[model samples]
Target chain A: MNDRIYMDNCVTSAMAPEVLEAMKPYFGEEFWYPGSFVSTGEASSAAFEGFREVIADALNAAPQEITFTSGGTIANNIALKGLALAHSGEGRHIICSTVDYPDLLTHAAYFEKMGFEVTYLEPDELGFVSAQKLKDAIRDDTILFMSTMVNHVVGTIQPIGEYSQVLAAANHKIWFHVDAGQAFGKLHLDVKALGMDTLSVSAHKIHGPQGIGALYVKKGSRLGAYIHGIKRFEGVQPGGLSLAAMAGFAKAVEIVYKDLDGSIKQLRELSDYLLEQLESQIEYVELNGPRGEGRACHNINVSLDFIEGEAITIMLDMHKITVATGSACASQGLKPSYVLLAMGKNQVQAHGSMKFTLSRYNTKEQIDFTVAKLKEIAAILRERSPLYNAIKKKQEK
Target chain B: MQYSEKVLQHFMHPQNVGEMENPDATATEGSPACGDQVTMYLKVDKENLIIEDVSFLSYGCASNIATASIITEMAKGKSLEEAKKITWRDAMEALDGLPPVKAHCSVLAADTLQTAISNYEIAHGLKEVPDFSKETIIGELKKIIYPQVGEDIITLKMVKYVGFEEKTGEVLIDLNLMSFDQYRDNVAEEIREHLQKYPEVKDIKINFPS
Candidate 1:
């Protein structure tokens, strides 16, 4: 297959060369378990410490505050469920936005099933969950307030710090969890600045290997009460970590932070140019996330009426262009995105959703190719559709 | 995940997906609930008793679109009656296996073909046609009563299923209620009153669910 235009980077990015090189040594010559007490294994333990330091430095977290997990989903589950279970005696009420990733909500759902009262806050039209909305939704019994910074599907950055300030002022003693899977390498993150108790990140998302991720557990935060452990960084995770993937994670973060300015600038330019090009070819193609500030520079989800996103995606894949209809995790369900539904789009518009996420590897030429192919596919599908005819009829009348 | 080679083959090289300019029959199935609809066209040779061509246009997910394409290929050379008999299972098999959640897609494909055959019969003035009026009204009523569990209400023997007088709007319904719950009765009564608002419904009969 000719170099397929990879648009599903939000699902997983091509591993960065530097990160790959960093992982190679650990996979072969230095492949020793960090937990081993043997004299030669001391180097592995030191390498593990270096991995923790890199992640800690990136997030402005204490090295002791970071806990490695299998991936973002597990980190999210741990954050939500661990908090709910540990604090269930304190208060059983948890408030989270409906726009949060379903896997995150699934963890919260388990709590709901276990007899906790959950209030799923809905985001506003632009995928913004306002601080006032959080304030109003908070109950006296609410013990946790959770949200995702930069929703993975739409890539809209939430006002985490603003919302956290309100929770801080109320002195509500609520544990705050921020699922920063999409935001990890793409944007700045500081655990203290956000006032969040727990934050999640995945390795593959930042051009590292899959099955390795980390969580930021702010020191003295309420979340620590829930996820307690004596071994391996205080027991947030009980098992010995994958030292090899961790090696990749550390290198990936190092590269991102080192080239953060240039990478983010390229992502923004590609995203802006792609949107501009798409707007020229398609009618009523509304950008689904934040139109200006508060949007992640790497993602652009759009809803184009008269075209089913799945059809466009298949046709694009045929042209060797890879993209996604929605979040890959829930794409198979065929339901209009719950995130978009919570953001106030009706079923038809929500079903016709497509997400274009840029990585450091994406370029302007690739974006141009994608837009042209998408235009052709969308136009062809629309021409064959009777619903498109009805829509056109309504527009004309 | 990598799909089986059969899936990728059908997906990558879909057989038929366009309109028939002069179709022997046309069918359109509308899924108002999910709002994903499909219209299919077929060219059948009556003397030969085989489909000469098949095509479809779908406004749905990838699985739905792919099912339509696969159905068109599968029905291309079959007789009208044989084509109409294409089950959701057969369509799914042609594509190896669709994700189970999307098995309903194959049903949509079959329904679209049935609708096109019905259209062809109407246009050609087939003398003896199945009376679709009663089933159509009942299907519409079921759509309102049991939005999520439409299939369940269909199986229940509680309502007095009736075919109404076309012009007078009078229904000959027999209702059976096995349970005496007020909530259940209220739902039944609401459906009854809503149907009465239609000009063609004049009278109804009730037999308590036994």
Candidate 2:
């Protein structure tokens, strides 16, 4: 009971002890801003570049191409707005999918309000915004196309390679930006192979400290200054980012990338076991996203029928288990998950949807315990549910 | 926002929960599509016109279950007239308080209780089936809480006008909510769900202060 089982890694995760250890010195006696002439400044500058290199190596990007930002949202803002402002003179049309992360969708809205034309492509039932749709939506005036590499809600991994080819085949240059906040450590990302003009990745998603993320800008690509301030770290979005967090971010990246495939496999196996246990123990459960390799490794979303999600989440919370739900009742705005809705789920399904994002820290025993408790909780909630009773009565007849 | 300790108590272990067999009257309110629904059962003492027993089954969130549990507790042993007088606010007060967003759950619970009582009265020939009119629409609208404030839209003066066409069964409402209001969609959705339950309402059109 003392150990809480946390499965909401998609939101955030427990920072690794090693990352904290790496960050301790930067927070203490060795703290110094990057500068020149002085030995302290030179040492700090060298350390900063080394940290940048670690993040760059994870994405197969050059160190100079990566700019450390405050977080994923900041990186997204800098990339999307900067790309739009830099290339707006050529065209004002932007393309994004309905099921993209809010970072990209909100930017699309802002671009629309700024008098730019936005084409919002709809995702398929499994939350796949196909590359063919991107190709079709492309126009001569399309200046930028934004996408989420891995959907934050359903974990559907978009075809970045195909998207890159589609944009490349276009007659004109259409700056491509990707919100890879969910994809950074969970999947293999190569900026050169993917050919995206700009991409954003966050550190906290991979057991790093919060408040630090990086943006990759392809060489020869120009970005208009979005954050105008003193030149500190990277000139792209000039501001003072936490040097200690950067060190921790690099350590987190190093640990994950040390055996990226092994880490992904571990997550996939845990999530698979979780899904299998849930299905075996529970009745009338339905998986919400892609079933196998098509989905990201860490996420397993499902909708349990005859009960609402908030009640189930609360019951699980009582047992010291944390999970996420798409229920409108649990949301601040009282709206169901837009990603679930856009994936063609009904209100009932969306309300019943539960998302379990596993990490390397999760275990088979934890999954089993979670499923067992969830089974009992589901039974209790169902017994108290009018919806379940109505359906049972119908089935009886 | 967090639920009160009392709310968590009732939600975790709700009282008078589950279906009641041989109920004198039963009524269901809200809808599955709206992410919440409650069914209430009542057993009234015909001679004394007192509610002998009351129970509820909810297909909603924690607050929804808590509100239903509290509403039943409040209605038990009370006269049918007294039970009908019980409002959502009283239930919220009894539960200490609910979050502003979850305040609508209390409304659903209380509405179901009142409807069950109304059903009992009509079945026992104590009252006639109420006529459906603009006033009925207004009464239903009063049950729709503006989640931002946990108050009825009518009480907040958010409902600028309400109109109903008797011949066409069309309901039209003009809300003072701005286009940018975060709760605008929620309010509109609740209004439609509330009115659409009435057989007289054929169509609903809600206009915001765009």
Model 1 has a DockQ score of 0.29
Q: Write the per-residue lDDT of candidate 2 for residues A86-161, one digit (tens) a residue.
A: 8999998999999989888888889999999999999999999999999999999999999999999989999999
The models' CA-based lDDT, in order, is 0.74, 0.92
Off by over 4 Å in 1: A34-38, A222-236, A327-330, A391-397, B1-26, B32-35, B41-55, B62-83, B89-101, B120-210
Per-candidate fnat, comma-separated: 0.46, 0.94
Candidate 2 residue pairs in clash (backbone atoms < 3 Å): none
lDDT of 1 by residue, A271-366 (tens): 888889988878769889787557888888898786677667767887888887742212543355778878887766776788888887877888
lDDT of 1 at B133: 61
lDDT of 1 by residue, B1-210 (tens): 334456556544556776678888787765422546788888877787578988887776666677787888778887777887776567768777765445554566666777677777777776455553667557534423321222224455455666667776556555554563433553454356435534555665544556
lDDT (C-alpha) at residue B63 in model 2: 94
TM-score per candidate, chains pooled: 0.81, 0.98
